[model samples]
Target: MDMGNRDTIGRRILIVGGTTEARELAGLLVDAGYEVITSLAGRTDTPRFPAGIVRIGGFGGKEGLARYIRENCIDLLVDATHPFAAQISANCVAAAADADVPLIRLERPAWKKPEGATWIEVGTAQDAADALPRGARVLLTVGRQELGPFLAYTGCHYTARMIEVPAGLPDDWRVIAARGPFTLEDELHLMQERGITHLVTKNSGGTQVAGKLEAAVQLSIPIIVIKRPRLPKANAVDSVVWAHQSVTRIFRTG
Candidate 1:
């Protein structure tokens, strides 16, 4: 798609991505005739690939990532990773600083509690588990990787929502194997059918699966929200469109 425009071509960008915003930003970069490479953390069994060139797996750590940035001639680094992926984001901040590469974050804003929803905000999954009341019928949508701390709360029965169910789940827990963009009707029905009294979820904000929050509000169900981690200071934007504009400005000025 390179149109032979000097301003739009030959610039190399690396997007540390795994979220919807990352995928959308990658497509925008490719359409603008820039060389784009997207990196996934490889935690998921089958991750969805973005529009442009894709690379899976970790870069070892900060030093290895810095070396990669040096070797690849990357002009910019865009971190559009998940809000809960604090370690990777921290590494990116360190690596970019070490390699002297400019970095920008395309982070989506956290969800606010809708009116009528009883929300209990906590700092982490462990804190959420601790705050959960005894014998509550819980809907756990915080993903399988963060289930360890919740497992200690045997008093509550959990209904986990995941892309794939894990083997040997606790006797008190069950899985609803699903992916999102769930309708409010579907979410409400699921909550009713499961008799879920409480929900435990991360505040990874986006429109994709926000129906659950709305459903919780409608049903008078309480939600335990794990707050996003405090990331290292960096240049950041909340929307993909603005991030695209920023990229174009960088290329034009260079």
Candidate 2:
């Protein structure tokens, strides 16, 4: 996988997208004169696209992904998907290994519960549901995909804020179709309006969605945060800046 200090002029790089980190890295790579392509899973009704080339939909699995890497001559593979996107991250590892391509992960660090914040950490959505007090009003921001487990809690009134509404939600639960980059003021008002006594969210680190946490803290609402699934160990960076530096180093050394 080592392509040490050589002519990197026309090198092709593939970034596994669906996160802010991926988009930022793609912009950096494109600015550095590399041919960059970002791949999205297409789960969202409207997914954000990065600056360079973009490909949507899954690659079938490891074999299909490997084929794409080979056909496109991808020199470097960057896994920058969502922290909770464990399956895609696993597939990326297998595909990169199969294709014999160097891979790195650009992952944002998981958010730590701040001091004075009332947080109840749990391993899964089910755990979060179980941890909630009976008959509590919950603000579920954990997305549509993982809503199934929480459905078992018919006693709790859940106000789900998602980009896409999920079917079969408990009748007692309510849904709000919306996107993020939510302001703190808006979040505070929402919590107040819904009488949100508890919040359910994945520990998806980054300031883009941190407003909810701030609002919760201000209102003294208890949060049931689902812990991040363990990612397979790999070469990784916590920031886009460091990821760009890694690519630059690889190109310079190659």
Candidate 3:
């Protein structure tokens, strides 16, 4: 039986992931009958997985990841890390070249202005904080790293949201310990429960936390969206569905 154009080589792929796109990609690869393994940074408290061979934690460094590549016979490498994760992306670039592996990056697109959504742009975390009104109840969707800057902004109450809360968040901060892919009803309720008048988030383009955005618009709360850096030069996809199509295009060598 002729298996027309199908490569005899079953792809041995390693996905470096710590984001929503990574999880979704891993699941899709498994269903596609590809030999896949996923690596997580283990940064979140309870990261939800989409099912496949999962490895939690780092690869030590480029040398370490290269070793794993050679040892496991990794044929393709996909870096689907967060936009802020410059270090990992650099390492992946170097290691893949050294190991002689083909690499692709799954970069989610940054947010664009939408009608009815008023976005105030800011360069830094402090700049975003300065744009907010004093003593106003704010829904802070900007992760934990940047929240410390706003700690000294007096009188303003905050509903600080993170995958996990740190030990030292200011007493004035009201912490919400939860992960995202959040629902509109949930975000709306949070806004209502806390009397939130402002929303602060990065221009992270995915629709996971977009519920809060809708809630902000409906309530007439201003949104402060910190812009993301330019994407590193590499093959990229903006969403899970598009990423699936990308892999489907990988040519099969007889």
Candidate closer to the true structure by lDDT (higher is better), 1 or 2: 1
How good is model 3 by TM-score?
0.87
Question: Candidate 3 lDDT, tens digit per residue, 25-65?
Answer: 98888888876788988887687775667789988898999
Task: State the lDDT at 227 in candidate 2.
Answer: 97
lDDT of each: 0.89, 0.87, 0.81
Candidate 3 global CA lDDT score: 0.81
Cα error, residue 65 of model 3, in Å, equals 2.8
Give the TM-score (vs. native) of candidate 1: 0.94
> Which segments of model 2 are wrong by more than 4 Å?
1-9, 168-171
Tens-digit lDDT string for candidate 1 (1-254): 33222233568899999898999999988987888889998877878898888889899998888888887878899999998888889989999999998899989989998998899999988999999889899999998889888887788888999887778897767788888889999999999999999989999998889999999999999999999999999889999999999888877887
State the lDDT at 132 in candidate 2. Answer: 84
TM-score against native, each model? 0.94, 0.93, 0.87
Pairs in steric clash, model 2: 4-253, 4-254, 5-253, 5-254, 6-254
On the 0 to 100 scale, the lDDT of residue 80 in model 2 is: 94
Q: Candidate 3, residue 133: CA error in Å?
A: 2.8
Write one digit per residue (lDDT tens) for candidate 2, span 135-249. 8999999988888877866787889999888676767678899988899999999999999999899998988989999999999999889999997888889999999988888
Clash pairs (backbone) in predicted model 1: none
